[model samples]
Target: MQPFMNSPENYHILESLDSLVQSISENQKEFFQKVSEIRDNHYTLVKSYYEESRRLIEMLKETAFLCSLMFNIQDEKSICASAINILRKLLENPVAIRILSTSNSHTKLEILAEESSAAFSIKSLCTKSPLSCIAIKTCRPIIHSPLESAVPCPEMMESPEQYAHICFPLIADGVAFGCINILFEHDTDIMLLKRNIDLINILAGYVSLAIHNNRLIKTVKKEALTDKLTGLPNRRFGMEALQNEINRSKRYGHVFSIAMVDIDHFKLVNDNHGHTEGDKVLTLMADLARKCLRNVDLVARFGGEEFLIILPETDIDKACVVVERFCRIFNEASLSDVLNAKNLTLSGGIAQFPHDGGDVLSLLKAADERLYLAKNSGRNRIVAGKLN
Candidate 1:
């Protein structure tokens, strides 16, 4: 009311204020939209992570089951089956999943699992896919960089698509065993894929541990049943082994023989050279005995200075020939080299099963008594025995 002239100025000011308000409103709308998008992306990531975590937990449980199963499995076929089931579950990819296996002796950075379909896919891309080498080279868990922007496949290389894959090395005891390869049908975002590498490492560690532990347990069991001193089966183990062989032979209607072996003057050497040297002499004798016998024969140290040899699929006559050969070999042992002894010799007593005795105890007793007879027969001869 005081100044009409200033009204124009006020109007201009109002117009500027309106424009600022509109600009502010527009900016707020854009900010909220961006925030919503971020939340959606975050939710998707979290969901994927949770799903993968669930899969991992299930895989670990299966590993536990496998651990228990391996304890009793002696044959190799069962081992393969258990491992395959686990891999299929872990990969769960439409692409083929392959497990690359290695031994304790194999010491190369390797993939424990592979999808040959990656090879096929890459080959389809350039007829020469570099996928195989690329997978082999990275040794890290995943490879997704070249996917969004892929190059031509190498001629020597072979894969079906311009796709990349995840490669995890299966390692144990600081040894690179092999790798497990996982390929996706579609390209995955690199950063997200890379984040899962830690989980892959965890899986690889478990795989290595399971395989190595199983193998170690089997080896330890074998060593436990074997005599370290004589490279033979110990008394208890031999009896057990003999029982198994006997059962097999009985089932097949085959014949087998058991022989009791006694070192002729083992005590004299032990008495002269102390137990340590005595141990060495015993070891040497064991090696000699093992060398003298057939691969199928089961020889064991029954006790101090005594051994048992079981010949499968053999009757009395055939048993005699083998026993005599072992006797001759024992007599010619290089005891002098180890015990510094003037001479070394062994005597054996032969007992044919189902002839000398029907049961384990009876056969063992008959063999023992015959062993004494061999000592009486002249400390270095085989005494073929009939049951007392």
Candidate 2:
């Protein structure tokens, strides 16, 4: 049997066994290659998912920050400032915010806030040709590189050639109210901006809503404190302002003055002329008073045909001078334009702080008493002191 195994006929069987072993070895090698390839593919998929998830998480945090801005900030400038800060952090680039307001069919761009890490001054890009801003004209997001276009935006010509620029129009209720301008320092930064477009858009939306809410709040507050007919501060605001002035005077030992003003024969104007004309008279008086008084003075409509003026850092003589000047201007105004009557005159009584009284009630009472004396003695002159 051992001799037969070594013979030429038996050698063919050994060759067949060897061939089978070689075929199995090749199949095992191919199988291992497929398994290794599949493992590599799985690892790539997991890494992609992880990166996407991390990006989403960061976006959520950023969105939450913008949402907080809506509730916390009330001033428009402050809101823009906060938005610019957060945007600079998220984009890792310089940022500027501008608001466009439409008035009389003309658009104006105001640069509200800016944040930059670079050592260059960032100014309003649309100062010369606001209408030429393509982003505002199209109401779309604009990604611009000076090197890529033949004719760049007119406003963008002054920007550095090394930096890329982006503009995101802030639209609310289908109207573009403002834009967020970003400066990309490098090509990689531009790529980053492209990848994070959706996130930046969401940020723009939040900022738009914040500005809208702030304007609404300011309008409501103005309407509440303002007199509708004369466009002056109403009685409630007047009293609050008086109290505030009193507090300031007491704290700083500063001398101030208050005056009670009355429109002379205002009822006769209403009775002779129509109430519409009377409204014009009130408006005229308000305009004249505002024009004559300094910016630090407060002229409020205390009641019908009555005004309370608070003059800060003014004594009795200066207060009297202010009222006398206002009276001159008020009397010289053309009343015949709106009404068939003579010129109007104003009677005012002035009182100094610490000389009259310390509190709002006492000061008001003293001024009112002097005003009554002015009305009884004659109706055209201002009285600064009580009768002896």
Candidate 3:
């Protein structure tokens, strides 16, 4: 203070410079450490999330494909198997799967898909916080958790073991008709879960759409080829189906029989009672024909008051017996008596595959010849084969 008083400004400047350098060095070290922490966190989060999203997408796609198989058959086995495979793939970390349907008054939970399925595990599947209905679903991008398991499914006490779950719902017409859930052995992050959910929803929506489309296609196809009154393949569908079956029999070296059925004096019933009575008779005849055949047989409304039967693996004799029994059952069911419409009777013409003729047109022509003979000979009886 005494000596530097003459040049105090210079001394002060030197001291301030030293202090500034120290402060900068300390800040740099702290910043570098922070950068390292952020880098590590980003790596884990990005990599895991990416892998999980990819896996979920793949599983969902596979599930969609599997569900598509339902269009092929009326049985439950194939459809259920396809659903299981989808859940097993999507929820590898989960203990099981539980499907819930919301199309009715009560929420019906169906175990459509599962892997290592628990005898009882409710905690992993549902909770009040994110009720099955409240759960989010998407046909678009998902950036958040779609379902919550925080409240724990109220049905948990009815189950066994610890479980967590994610849900995929099938929505149509603004209604959530069905849901698919993944049961996990542990809890998960809300954010990551939201992403997983998005993937699942995309899958669910696609599958639901496909199923709906296929169902509609089936209904339309049935209607197009079927006679609504008789529940038989309509003329349009009958021809194509017969042609296809004819080819199948020849290619496979299997015997088949074709029969054309007509109501004997059907026009008289229409004229006497009304068309209503005639329609009833037609329906009854189809029902009787259906009851007489094996699972592989096909029946079609060949035309007005006319029906045809395709019997795979059957010869002319067997076809004749089948038709005869069908007629007997018709008499037993007694539709005309029950409805009080008209007492009905029928005449039929039968032909064996290959033996009767080589093709659909040829076989049909031969059967028509027999039918003509039967009608002229006197009605109410069967005309089978070449009549030889």
lDDT of residue 23 for candidate 2: 96
State the lDDT of candidate 2 residue by residue for 242-329, as single tens digits: 9999999899999999999998999988899878878888898898878888999999999999999999999999999998899888
Task: Estimate, for each residue in 106-221, the C-alpha lDDT of model 1 and write its tens digit.
Answer: 33222233334434532232112223434334554545435565443242234446345555655667755455555556555556556456655665666656666777887898
What is the lDDT for 253 in model 3? Answer: 92
Best TM-score among the predictions, by candidate number: 2
Which window of ten consecutive residues has the lowest lDDT sum in model 2? 95-104
Regions of model 2 farther than 4 Å from truth? 1-24, 94-106, 128-131, 145-158, 334-339
Instruction: Give the clashing pairs for model 2.
Output: none
Q: lDDT value for candidate 2?
A: 0.80
Worst 10 residues of 1 by lDDT: 122-131
Model 3, range 1-388, lDDT digits (tens) per residue? Answer: 5666457796888788888888888889889989999999999999988997787667667666665565564433344455656545544455555554542344344444444544654544443222334343332321222144355434343343444545566666675555665555544455555545554665566555655565577788888877888877788787787889888877899888888877788888888878997787787777766766777888888888877788888999998998877766666665545555544667789998889888889888877777777888897778994675
Which stretch of 10 consecutive residues in model 3 shows the poorest summed lDDT?
Answer: 137-146
Regions more than 4 Å wrong, model 1? 1-84, 92-165, 169-199, 273-277, 335-339, 385-388
